[model samples]
Target chain A: MAVTAQTTKLDARKLRADFPIFEQTFHGKPLAFLDSAASSQKPRQMLDAMREFYETSYANVHRGVYQLAERATAALEGSREKVRELLNAPAAREVIFVRNATEGLNLVAYAWGLNNLGPGDIVLVTELEHHSNWVPWQYMAKKTGAEFRMLPLDEHGELDLGALDEAADGGNVKVVATGLVSNSLGTINPVEKLVAWAHERGAIFVCDAAQAAPHMTVDVQALGCDFLAISGHKMCGPSGIGAVWGRAELLERMEPFLLGGHMIRSVRFEGTTWGELPHKFEAGTAPMAEAVGFAAAIDYLHGIGFDAISAHEHELVSYALDRLAEVPGLTTYGPPADRRAGIVSFNFDDIHPHDVAQILDLEGVAIRAGHHCCQPLMQKLGVAATNRASFYLYTLPEEIDQLVDGLHKVKKVFA
Target chain B: MSDGLDSLYREIILDHYKNPRGHGVIESADAEAEGQNPLCGDEVSIYVAFGEDGETIDEVKFSGRGCAISQAATSMLTEMVQGRTATEVATLDKDELLEEIGIPLTPVRLKCAMLGLTTLKVALHKAKGTPLPEGIAGFDELDLK
Candidate 1:
């Protein structure tokens, strides 16, 4: 319970028992999973919830009058309530379910962006944004004639606050969108400070919490972000179910994207009337099973405590960074200690990232290679590509040893 | 096949990576073609000198900064194409190249390795004043001009 930052040990043995893939082997060896930033393994609870919904309580919600439909409606609406509890949103109405974080951001950008932004309106984004965060604003800029600008990064990968203030100072910027943690470098942005700055400039702040929500406690009210996006799969939930948590007033003011069946209150040949708040955003027959799975995943996280998950991940990340440094030619990217999350991106000297990934795979250790979907950040880091070995709550120190040993083997092979 | 898995990371592959063959400039080349991997910003340029037969590749060279896959693949391709007929090299398909290298590539990296092949093929076709294949997103636009 005394969660020390670096020395804490987690029993993923119990966690692994919940997810069966850990028992499997890759290339005839126990799989050393270091690609959790891409996606995390789901717990049995989430898997079971999806199956149970399909088998027993399967029905279309709100439209059907059967008892199964009543159960499905309660379950679907219940997941929204759980998301509200998870983020501590003021009401369940604030949490709008979407396909994933990308679509969620697009919903806000297309809806709010279309209405608010004009020729000179500026949207401030960070240098480390994923293409998901970067491209929407660019599309908005192209469509609405707004100017998309970047908040520059310091040497440590933190956004330059002075540049942010300068961008926001004129009050011309409509939105300040940034990621809570960079997926490539594992650099945790100072998002709370950024939110305050955006607020000062009367700019709506949006946080891409895809990487952060899995490892840290997120409170929308405390952070004071007008809109925040979270992907379920990056945590321990199923894909195709993500939530966009916005303030009730903000959600009400925004227009619905993807006009369709479930999102309307009434329809006719003439322009139909729309539903309120969350339903307005969710257009079609939603991913009912996926929503239930996500709700179950939130329960699993709360049961384990998000604080414990954070401590466990930080300890593993610290161990990984330290151990990786000893791999002779390994050069790590991103900020110093305590400035990042469980993600660790590094490169080996004179070796291509693909070679590093291949070498690691030989040792049954999995890692991600290439630009990690952040080409601009790759340009910023001055590397063509990097071999990244990210961590999660279920990861153990022995696996980090496998990565280290694998690096040594790569050095030996290429020496 | 050092570790029973035949690690796409073969000794020959590593050798090609470390001491890449046919590297650097060929100033006397008739035509040059280049390709860039947009995903990671790795660039490759293949320089060629053609024989009087218009198909025989008398000289072949390349220069690039990329993963061992791209660099080593380029090295292997240079070795394979040098002194071969440009028709032979142009007819060199992806499976044949992968077969010669004796390794499987992940879908995307396979394209990285094939960039040199495509570049070599384009250079040969360009020198002959022939038309290029359609729907090649990376280079077709550039070649169109």
Candidate 2:
């Protein structure tokens, strides 16, 4: 797919202007936002699309006969179609809308694992997984009396693929779940090879694309994963909206995660018949405007083109790694720049991550400081917490320079 | 360089953090309690020894690892409550500890500032049979009051 002419020639400085939050000065300086992994700043296009939906075409979807309801229903389904394209799923019916990636993962755990998994079955996850991906399977294993195993990372902060093969050699692995990209360490896993391994073991693969979907091109079909989950807020869309794309046959065989108004074909007093495919999974009133915003965000990302976004981020991460290495006592985690996304997690020698974050905040540089919902990963890395700086399309090279300047200030203060 | 940073990381706090007083465990302590800020992975353990009367804290010490504010606050807390009665230590307010640190804290940092006090209260409660006050130990449900 060719990128539109306008976006192919995009100037990031002008692109930054589209996000209104950038206009506001922080601490009497330009806000150097480096926390996009937590949640991305929304562009005007997404905001306007959501506002336009609520103002002009506001109505309940699917059942009402009114014109407004028809428009809303069309828009909602249209967004699903957009998501299908975004993920390169075979069909629109494979796209299931949920609250966020957490909810999407939970849905898979409940709907699929609860039914298919049993005693002696193993659900394999990695230490690199966010708590969302790890905990759901942990709960599922406990609830279903199955075994939950975690593949440990090597010293290089990359998943030990050898361990994965050894663990799956028994063929009891029912589900292989892992993240496409590590939110904390920024290591990008080889999902294509992982999916092939899972298939060879007769196990289903689930990819948590919460970090990958925003920064890279995620083609679920090309990766050949059984299920992939993505978050909307991480991709410049509104919060409380995310999607899961599953193989159509698998979605058909699995039961619904939630049951309510829109997800039923017929609800009798005694028993209820579930709706078809995606609707069966998405129960109750859906996030209509959020879905619209998600579609707009997809359009926005498409306008910029994934190739360009990936190339830009590669350069940024390379530069950031080189620049961050100059700071004394600064230690970073994750694979080298080529194997990672734009995230950089590090800590100064003696200064705690929280203190570093606090000091950096004084310079109007926003970075994340905490366990980053990867406590297991943190324990494995032998660190209490790390300061993470993540990048997005709007990030400028100068902002990274600013971050280096801020780190120097932190060193001086702690010295 | 900002005044806000100066207030948050005062010289006294940094001094205590770098060279903590009353650090290390009381090997023969009567009671001990450990607290952790799961959000930032800061941990503090407070150990206490009751005086002959078994009412006053004969010696109090803490051993843990955390940020500057948390460690310094723990060091300061051991010094502040060493000679006080267990009952008095149990009744010590969080504000008094914050005032002792003499720095304005955001809600997030307030938990760090109070980690030592919360651990001290728990240690006192365990030693002197005082009731454990709610919302003092858990950072998730820390009562800012």
Candidate 3:
């Protein structure tokens, strides 16, 4: 996806028609959404696809010989291929569906951690890692006696590459897991370089691409990482679905993380033989309708074109940063807008994050506040939380205007 | 900005957030415990200076960074609970406090508003060395407030 900086205005009237929820008023006020980083709003296409699946063809996959079951199985497997295409994954088998990025990362930590890492092994994480990516490794370190280390952030809230390179090239690291983009600060990490550094130390590199997949084009093969995890909900899909993309050979070599009925081909009271590569990890019945919804989400994005969507969001965030700069005593977090995605974290002098959010909500402007699943980043920034206004493809400059207008309201509340 | 914001940012609430009351360490206190909202990342370490005289709370102090609702509730709590018995404040109504602030809150914001009193109730129980009542820490769900 080549995003060449869209100069066109994002038409709210046209974009709002794609999202049905905009029709309803939230708290007796017109909703001005700005919380896409938390969970993106779904388009009608995705919702309609899920409803169609349930209404026309709904059955348990891979368990029955009935016609409906066969169709459901085909559709579920087809969604896996859609995800593979979406990420430019080399093979469809590398895409394993899971509950969300949290679950997908946990699978790698539990299965890969138990097999590859042991005493004296080191796993390198970073300050910008989401707790989902950080805590699982911490638990693995505690269980297997592997040392858990962190790559520090630079003064500008981006990764300190010199420090990361020193740790990565030190030869003590067995695995490296970091975010492709910072969810809190929106700093896009140098994944291409980080992957090379980790591989040089004979370590496997896994990227948490939850933030990156939603805002930019993701190519797992091009990224040259062993594995990448992303949630469907963040990318305009429904909840309860996500995918983990890994190299086919690596996934085949890794052990199964979760065990249940659908994961095994043959079972005895004492032991069981696992199924094929992807199915071996899918425990119980999967979120079938959700997988279909995810496919529709990819189709919806492809329709608008990912490059245009990303460029539109970039234009909006840049405009927002400029407008927010005019607010006195306001401090924006993370790297400058040019280097980051659309997520903007900031703090206003003499105002708490909750107050800012509450004031914004009164104006019908939705924003996210609190640790944002990055408590370590918050600790490093020396603040408990910051108010974040993140945008998606459907978000408009008018909404950014509303956010700027809302900040003035926030200042007045505390003034 | 609108005239409606004035109610939410009442003078007392801003005063407390700007200059919190009863800050610092309360040494040799009878009871002390820390409570934090992991959802919003707001924390408060409250120290209770209740004596063997029991019912009366000699002092209470809290330290945390949160919205005006939490800090204002804390500041008002220290003033409301000083020299009053633990039982009296526990029975004290939460609705009256919001009525004083004169701003209605959403379901989520009400928790920030009540975080102080809820923690105080727990600190009181710790002072008396009694079991905390079930669901005492979470009281914002009902419209009773």
**TM-score for chain A of every candidate model?**
0.96, 0.97, 0.96
Candidate 1 local lDDT, A1-415, one digit each (tens): 1213343345666788898788789878899999999999888889999999999998998789989999999999999988888888899988999888998899889988899998778898888998888889988988988888888888877778877657655548889899999999888888899888788777899889988898888889888899999999998999999999888887788778899888988898887888987888888898899999999998888777777777787788888888877778789988875888888988899788877887788788999988888888888988878888888878889999999988887787778
The best candidate in terms of TM-score:
2
lDDT of 2 at A239: 100
- Per-residue lDDT of A117-233 in model 3, one digit per residue for the tens? 987789999999999999999999889998888999999998998887566443479989999988888899999998998898888998999999987888888899998999999
Docking class of 2: medium
* DockQ ranking, high to low: 2, 3, 1
What is the lDDT, from 0 to 100, of the residue A349 in candidate 2? 93
Worst 10 residues of 3 chain A by lDDT: A1-10
**Local distance difference test, per candidate?**
0.83, 0.89, 0.84
* Model 1 residue A111 CA deviation in Å: 1.6
RMSD of candidate 1 to true structure, Å: 3.3
Output DockQ, candidate 2.
Answer: 0.74
Instruction: Please write out the lDDT profile of model 2 over residues A192-263, one tens digit for every residue.
Output: 998998898889999999999998889998999999999999999999999999999999999999978789
Candidate 2 clash figure, as a count: 0
Best by lDDT: 2
List clashing residue pairs in candidate 1: B55-B86
Which 10-residue window of candidate 3 chain B scores lowest in summed lDDT?
Answer: B136-145
What is the fnat value (0 to 1) for candidate 3? 0.73
TM-score of each: 0.92, 0.95, 0.92
